[model samples]
Target: MTEYSEISARLAALSDDQLTVVLQAATAGRPAFWAVRAALDEMAGVGNVTPGTDVSPATAAPGVHDQVTGGGVSGQVGAASTVPAVPVHPAGIPDAPAPGGYSSGGVPTFESVRDKVEQRFGTAQGMGELDRQTPAGRSADEQWEAREKAARERLDRIRKSMHDNDTP
Candidate 1:
């Protein structure tokens, strides 16, 4: 692509508003920011534009034409330009998380740590007092006592029902 400087003459076709949009985006170090800037400066001069306009292409000093795109817009795009310039993989879309955490400063990040550390004080169903509402069956000691009593009663009934085989 031709540098903005090479295309400065062509920019005259764009209206004042259009020129402003290009200038705003180009300040982020888009290729040919200097050329867009030069066009704006020329418009300001020819149209008797008021100083109220923020056309102060701070990246490009008056008469200091650094035609290189990345020069004057140093730090304009900042860390964003650090993203990989390669096209997205054509094979398939990446997973939602893309593996590591979203740290961009060379460090891979993991998902937010949300350990499901649960603590139960009294019962499994609910909080201490609330557990009483749920019928969780008899306690171990109570169940054992009830079971033993039933067994003894059953044995007595069986003894009464048994025939005296020794006597026979």
Candidate 2:
């Protein structure tokens, strides 16, 4: 196989246990993990408390609930059914949670981090009328910019330290 094809096949063979270790390392303090963690925290705060529902994406065991839910083997011994099962949400749990938690209505669609940052900061231009109206909003924007700059600088320093300590 060519180098790219060999790499692709190797990646395809990675088990879920192996992938979880890679994912945790990659997302340690990043925004994507932060968002997912926030969602999980919201779920916990609401005390969903179902036997299978409390499983975290990181440590969740595959097929543990399958036995109880009748996700058992079909007529063909090893073949999984081609039909996709519809997800059933429990009562009182919101279909889509907003940034912090549950909202009044409407399903929350996934937005790009850039889009969310722009929306939060009013840089998406016409998105936030109220943000453009007030002096306090302008102050908050300035504070956000300053904090973002500091975070970037901190990351730069950490990267530099890693590079400097690398073995030749």
Instruction: For model 1, give the 10-residue run with minimal summed lDDT.
Output: 80-89
Give per-residue CA lDDT, model 2, range 39-132, as digits (tens): 5444333234556555567874647532224242344677664233322345576554456433446544445454677676775565466775
Q: Find the candidate with the highest lDDT and give its number.
A: 2
Once fitted onto the true fold, the runs of candidate 1 whose alpha carbons sit more than 4 angstroms away are 1-61, 65-140, 144-168
lDDT for each candidate structure: 0.49, 0.55
**What is candidate 1's CA lDDT for residue 153?**
100
Number of the top TM-score candidate: 2
Task: Please give, for residues 80-156, the per-residue lDDT of candidate 1 as tens digits.
Answer: 43111222224464434433444444444344222122333224445544644446633644677899999999998
Clashing residue pairs for model 2: none
- The list of candidate 2 runs beyond 4 A from truth reads 1-127
